[model samples]
Target: MLPRPPRTVQVLALWAACTATSLLILRLGAADTGATPWAGPAPSWGEHLRFWDAGWYERIARQGYPAVLPVDGAGVVQQNAWAFMPLLPLLTGLLTWSGAGFYPLAAVVCLAASAGAAVVLDRWLAPRAGGAASLWAVALVWSSPCAAVLQVPYGESLGLLLVCAGLWLAGRRRFLAALPLVALAALARPVGVPLTGALGLWWLMEEAQARGTVPRAALARLLPGHEVLEARQRRGLLVLVLGAATATAAWPVAAWLVTGRVDAYTATETAWRQGAAPDVLPWLARSATWVGPHLGWLLVLGVLAAGALVLSAPGVRSLGAVPWCWCVSYCLYLLVFFDPTSSVFRLLLPLAPAAWAVGRAGTRVRALLLVAGVVGQLFWVSWVWDRTVQMTWIP
Candidate 1:
């Protein structure tokens, strides 16, 4: 058999193909919906990228966030730009300050970031799974459900890019270099809270092993111990663990400082849900309103069990301590904090590495799975993404 092209070339070709097709589908979405006589012609791709949270990011780009939060007569915070972090908009604004249109420039930013993420993801996966499997893994990420988010003016692509890059760096014990990337990743989409947890857990495991604690069998699945770890690497891990914690806390603290309210970020985020009462399990509480308390709780338990099984699968665990820890920590973060919505799937995009587990199937199985993913992407973008005709569902 002939040799494959360079991995970067293969990855970009897949990225371009999937991206162009997704844009074509989004174009179909932009056409006049027959809801109004004057709905007019389809918009440019730049305009097509402006749906959903793009509006909020654009508001942040054009104008700085409000010093004082907006509230209704009842004194509850309203949904506003504070709900978004600044990096994507800040980059868009800086690039467009010279008279470039926001959507067009922002589109370039998102697309390029996505391309970078494809490259970084491939690099991260190759050593563990070999070149061919890793290439297929990149394709799976680009074609997964809600992949259009990468093509739009959103933070997931940029955040994932920096995050994967940071993980790659830190995995080699280059913790100093990983610091800024992790902090920026946090600002991109708030994934840092989970990242911090992952690193803290990893470091704790290493420290425990070094101190002759945590039994080898109990820690067997977690990580390789300190036998190979040097003092410098341990120091770096400690520094990185501290930095990740601070980075994870950065945005919420910034919001607090600017708004003079300790709960500034949390309050703005809840506006999307119209606020819910305090609960030990907010996810269960929200689900109960839809499906009844008993079934809702069963659903919650089912979700947790499903997540645990998926993470423990051989393929997923093979992604190594970094990806596995991040995946597990992120699931915990979602369970405690996330309110169940159709949009919850969008929040799960960072778990794309889990695709590697599924990629380890037989050739025919992989092919069938790819076909299923394409079908899933079609419905996901149609029912969840294309808001012009299908405005009832949130992606």
Candidate 2:
């Protein structure tokens, strides 16, 4: 019998097909505002997808962060390039520094990085979820609902790549190696903040177990903590956790250092909230306003319940301690800090571990999800890329 193709080859082929399809769908149509799809005068098809947050990245890539923060009439800092992470744009800027355009070259970079993310995720999940299950997980993730951003000039692709690399390394008790990748991932996106908790939880498990000296009962199942790990491993794990903390702080510190303002990053972030506090209340209000005041709390409770169910599923739980912690932490971060928005879907990309469960979920279920996800991609690509939807959605 002939040998099968390697998993990485399969992953790349799937990625290429999806990327080509997404670009084709985008090129064939821009966005229709009820009348017809609006194809703006952007030089290429990818340019149509590069707007909103892409515009901010393009600005950052074209000209670095402004030394002076832009402010409104009321002395409030308005949204600016500081609100977005620099790594994606800075990397993209490398190509554009030679006079190439921003979005097209960025599209290439994002495609390559996201491919790396798929391969990492494939290897990362294989041990925990068998080879077949891991392949299914990768397929589901690359073709997920908001897969559009995977190809666009967004941070999600590169950030996810780094985040998964960090998770893969950290899971194997390779703390020292994971730290710099985690830091670079942090530099790419806000997702690094949640990764800190993932690493911290792993450290706590190992550190607490190591201190016990007496063997821990296996039931509680504190992962990365086994009978074999020594004092040195525990110490290295602690370093990983602290390094995650420092990585999360790098952006804010850099923003402050550059702009010479203590509140540069926070002020810029809050500009979007228009002074709303970071809490569940804003999310509740948004939900209530969207649905109704009476059902608002129910809606919030329902989402929490749904997340609990999803995370607790056998497949997700099988992802083991570090990845599961990341899923929970990222969810908590979104719930606490974010108000509901269309962009929330894209923010859920890091939750790909759940797809492991979804993948193992019966063949029929996987097929259904794939179909729904494709439909979602078509809708999201056409809907979000359309300029008119920009007023209501942030994808």
Candidate 3:
């Protein structure tokens, strides 16, 4: 057999392939539906990148967010510009200010961020899994059902880049260096808050082990007892915690300053649910309406069981304390807070680390799973992207 290319080469090739395939799929869907890729009256390649949340980002870029929240005649908060985060729009605004068109610049920003994320994932996994396995992990992440989000102007690409890069830095014991990335990640999406929480939990677990007080058997075995953290570790942990807290508060605090309401961010987010309660019963009832009662409950239970099994996999459990903690904590956070709508798949993009567990399988199994993921991506793009532009679904 011939020698393999460097891991970087392989990863880049994979990222390019996946990105091109996604764009092709988007183009085909647009043609079939007689819709253009660009947002307005004319068709253009940039159209494919401007859908759903892309419009919000473009608006923020062209015209800054509202100084005050907008409310309808009924006193309900209408979808105001503040509902979205600032980082992506700020970047797009800078590009637009430089005389670049909004949609094209936004697409470039998203595509670059997406590629950077894949590279970071490869580097993070290469040490734990060999080159081949790490490559598989990257492939799986890019081929996820909602992977199309990476190609759009949405914040998921930038958010994933920060999360993965921060975690990778943390894995190398560069806690201080990871702090700023985590801070930025927190601003990218609400997932950053949980990401910081996970890092803190990891630090606590490390501290506990250092103090010879193991909280659980799994943790005890994962991190054998050692003397209390060196002065450096302790200092690093303090800085990380402070940075994370500040980052998490950045959005909420901004909202409060703008709207003079403590619940400004929460209220804007809740508006998307249209006043619907977040209870599981309501979700199940809604699902029942779409698919009969018997199948609906069964589907819910099946998803829960599958999630539990995946989380419990030995590979996932065996991850280094920080990654494991981050994964489990993030998953639990989503379960309680995120509504189980179709968007859940997109929301789950932060769980990219879980792909490592799948990559641990034998070559044949890994290949089959990768193929399945690619197929899922095609179908997901067709279903979500096609319908979302038609106003049939919310991406």
TM-score of each: 0.92, 0.92, 0.89
Whose lDDT is higher: candidate 1's or candidate 3's? 1
The parts of candidate 2 lying over 4 Å away from their true place are 31-43, 97-99, 211-215, 218-229, 387-391
lDDT tens digits, residues 271-343, model 2? 8999666888887888898789999888889999998887776667666777777888888889888878878
TM-score winner between candidates 1 and 3:
1
Tell me the whole-model lDDT of each prediction, alpha carbons only: 0.79, 0.78, 0.76
The clash numbers for all candidates, in the given order, read 0, 3, 2
- Tens digit per residue, CA lDDT, model 3, 85-168: 888877777776567778788778888889999999878866665677777888888877788888888999999999889888
Candidate 1 residue runs with Cα over 4 Å from true position: 1-4, 32-41, 222-228, 277-280, 388-391
- Worst lDDT run of 10 residues, candidate 3, spans 220-229
- Report the C-alpha lDDT of model 1 over 1-395, residue by residue, as the tens digit: 99978768888998899788777667776664323222335655665666677878888877889889999999999888887878898888778656878877888889999999988888887777777777777777777777888878888888999888888788778899999999898888878888888888777777777787876555656432223356778789889888989987888888999999999888998888787633347777767976898898888878878998998887787677777778888888877667777778788888877877676777888788777777777777767665445356687
Model 3 clashing-pair count: 2
